[model samples]
Target: MGRETYTGDVAFEVRGHLGMITLNRPKALNALTQLMCESILIQLQDWAEDPTVAQVLIRGAGDRGLCSGGDISSVYRDMLEHQPRDGGGLLPESTPSYAAAMPAEEFFAVEYRMNLTIAEYPKPYIALMDGVVLGGGVGVSAHGSHRVVTERSRVGMPETTIGFSPDVGGTYLLPRSPGNTGLHLGLSGIHLTAADAIFTGLADTFVPSEALEELTQQLTEHPVDEVLPRYAKHPGDSAVEQDAEWIDAAYSAGTVEEILVELEQHSSSYPGAQQAAAALRAKSPTMLKVALEAIRRGAQLSLSGALAQEYTIAIHALRSHDFREGIRAQVIDKDRTPRWNPGQPETVDEDLVAHYFTPVPGKLLSLE
Candidate 1:
């Protein structure tokens, strides 16, 4: 009979039996923060077992979409101000990412945990993913039981552009793609349209951007299982699927370097593969290797296991110069040119990539 009370960037309330969550940061593209993440986690955890709450729905304010990703500006600032006593070596590792004292440490730890919660949630979890659903946006919406994408949806995990690997269970999500398309997308950081998202299994159904509000209202009135089917409709043909043959062949190579070599050999015939190869070439060498390894390893592991592995990579990657430089160029400086320290992929050898997998002192991620 009464609406639930909540405060912070994430707005939560109960409309009838529908538990509603609105990402309140329109200007920031609803970029996720620890507070937003924690609020979401708590509400979802409570609603999961509440019989009165029949389902959950999450969306973003403004036209931008569900969420852009984690607060990378804060992460960039932290990296700049962080004076490592060990000289870019590992921090104390009181937690998964940093020493217990570090404020940013809890961000991913909680965020990853929240992602896991959505993945494991028993009740129906619906996400209204629209407009610029990249990085952190993918994490929130991709795991939902009913992932609703719009005609305006533009989704991708473009972390490699900023010298970061895809995290928040990307390792699990990417490898599950039908073919080497996952590897190609992971390495290239290209955005996918609504049709592409459904083809790639990132989203379930397509609902027009204008119709989403009506759908939400319907969810409050009827069961999601009933209301969703009424609105779900086919978007269109996917352009990403056109390149499936090339992606399978190029990304079939075990490593990013091998993939690049394959792309290079075919560059004369397939301009698309050539362009994909060039995009990979422009990304951070260390991150390319890390992203490759993450997906490869994730194929064999559970969702929780993948999150744990990513936690290790994110913390270790903080030591690298590319992360800070990538952020400066893309976020702070607004320049597209990020001068990667090891510009060439060849320079980032296996040993260097191994450092990211090395565990820290504090507790790692666990759904159990």
Candidate 2:
């Protein structure tokens, strides 16, 4: 009967039949933390069963973005403090004694589980995806039933730039995009405009940034299906869709190496083709190969299956040299130059790639 509000890094409020979630860490662009993930999951579960809650909406607190990604700085710190032994003889962090103590592993597990929840949420889950939505941001918004993007939206999964492959359901969602646009975006870690986001199937509608507040008011009073029609507008043309011929042609190649060759070959006709190749060339070679493989394999798997597979890869990546170096260059040191171990995509052998999929002992994701 009365308004209810809860607050922290994540906030929750109940207005009329609409339950709302606000990612509260605007300074960090609402970068998700383990506690935030757990909090969202708990609230989602509660709302899913509450008859009074007809639907739910998630938005970021500040104008910066919906969510930048997971709090990788925390993950970086945990890995640094608990560096695995060289020969892999270290005891398992998932062991019963240290289960709750393993922050990095637990963060991935909780975040991935929250992603799965969004994908399968019963009630309409509307996401106001304004500003910079990357990596973990994609997981939260893209999975929602009603994903709205604005002109200011800059969405992508940029894990490869940080020497890590995409996670938090990126493999499942990106591969399902039109043609090879997903592969191109995933490999290159490029941002998409609102039009491009809708074209790529990441967003359902486009609403002007200024209209979001009024739209929210409408949503509180009426159902999303009824309210969205009033605010959804044409986001104009998607540049990615215009360049789909080159993007699909280049990205459909058998491997990362061949994909580059295709991009280079198409450069004469398409201005962005050579740039795409250069972007791919700049990212961590190991992560590029791993990301490609995960996306390819993800296409054949269900969201849960893809998430499970990603969990293994994420655990393996925690011990990878590239992951740490990536965070250092991109986030900590701001060097913008990460010296990836393999250095070349061709040097990332299949055997080494296969090792990433090997399940970690005591760390399997039990997503039903």
Candidate 3:
């Protein structure tokens, strides 16, 4: 049999019984695009049915890491040029048409579906998370049965910082993180170390960055379950573990207001908590409330259910001033100064928060 040919930023190659995937755009930190998601999903789906394929391995090219996340700049542009939909009467006058928005809407809808695929993939999906893995990057790597991280790994769902809540299955994944640390990370947009990733259940094994090449070579020649074990090393100290007590105390409150208050109370003795609180203050308040609620609801729901809830919030967020402004400052303008509308977390009323979960007037996600 002859080898199949493929091309683009995402590439696939079959080596012996192993199928391998590479996110090739190292310049942008391998930021995912719709094409990459489609490539990954198609390759995995194909590999799942192929009996000759023992397992699959995925990694990013370049030294930076696996991937940063979805291409937010592309998504933001879609929202800006978005047209109206459903006879154009459903959305508010000021709100962008979530139904009509190109790319971002389609991106999330497709990206989330891809995430579910990984979560339920039949064969072993080994991810080499050697660098900055965030947003959509997490969706791809975190769901796999055998997620491997390196000392160079830095991971998180930093949607809040971009004036957006974490999407790409973050609603499902973050809540599942250990001891309310998920909530703390989701709200604060903090990056976790490889050791912390293992502690938080994000990655299964810890291997040195340099060992990845040998691991890949071994995977190409043998079964992943047998090969990965030989190279696995103990991921040393986890900062998140040391701070878990402080996190659960500060972030477990019922509301964002209460959470911030608790963080303030601990500010004197735990400067980390104080700093975390201050970081939360810089993000969109409306998003903060919505993110917390989504995570809480996610803890109780299945992956599909959590994804459904997140879709609603993502649609609602497009209508908010913050999401747009957040992207403009942090991404477009590169100013790092997002003038949040509500200014304070307490000012965002519960009623506004409720609107996020309201049924979106468009096609529903076909997760099954």
Task: Return the lDDT, model 2, position 194.
Answer: 98
**By lDDT: ranked, best first:** 2, 1, 3
Misplaced by over 4 Å in model 2 are 84-101
Q: Which ranges in model 1 have alpha carbons more than 4 Å from their true place?
A: 84-101
Tens-digit lDDT track of model 1 for 1-368: 64866856988889888999999999999999989999899999989878889989999998877888999899877776664422332344353345533456668889999999999989889999889898888899899999999899998999999999999899999999879877877889999999999888899999988899899988987988899889888989987798788888888898878989999888898888889988998898889988998899999989999999988887776656777778889998988998886778877667778878888766465567
TM-score order of candidates, top first: 2, 3, 1
How far residue 169's Cα lies from its native spot in candidate 1, in Å, is 0.4
Q: State the C-alpha lDDT per candidate.
A: 0.85, 0.90, 0.83
TM-score of each: 0.94, 0.95, 0.94
TM-score of 3: 0.94
The whole-model C-alpha lDDT of candidate 3 against the native structure comes to 0.83
What's model 1's overall lDDT? Answer: 0.85
Positional deviation of residue 56's Cα in model 3 after best superposition, in angstroms: 0.8
Per-residue accuracy of model 2 over 1-368 as CA lDDT, tens digit each:
43566799999999888999999999999999999999999999999999988999999999899999999999889877766423321234454423434579889999999999998999999999999999999999999999999999999999999988988898998899999999998999999999999999999999999999999888887999999988989999999999999998888899999999999999999989999999999999988989999999999999999999999988878877788888989998998998888889888878788878888677799997
| lDDT, residue 355, model 2 | 79
All models, RMSD in angstroms: 2.6, 2.8, 3.1
CA shift of 153, model 2, Å: 0.4
Report clash pairs, candidate 3: 65-131
Model 3 residue 248 lDDT score: 91
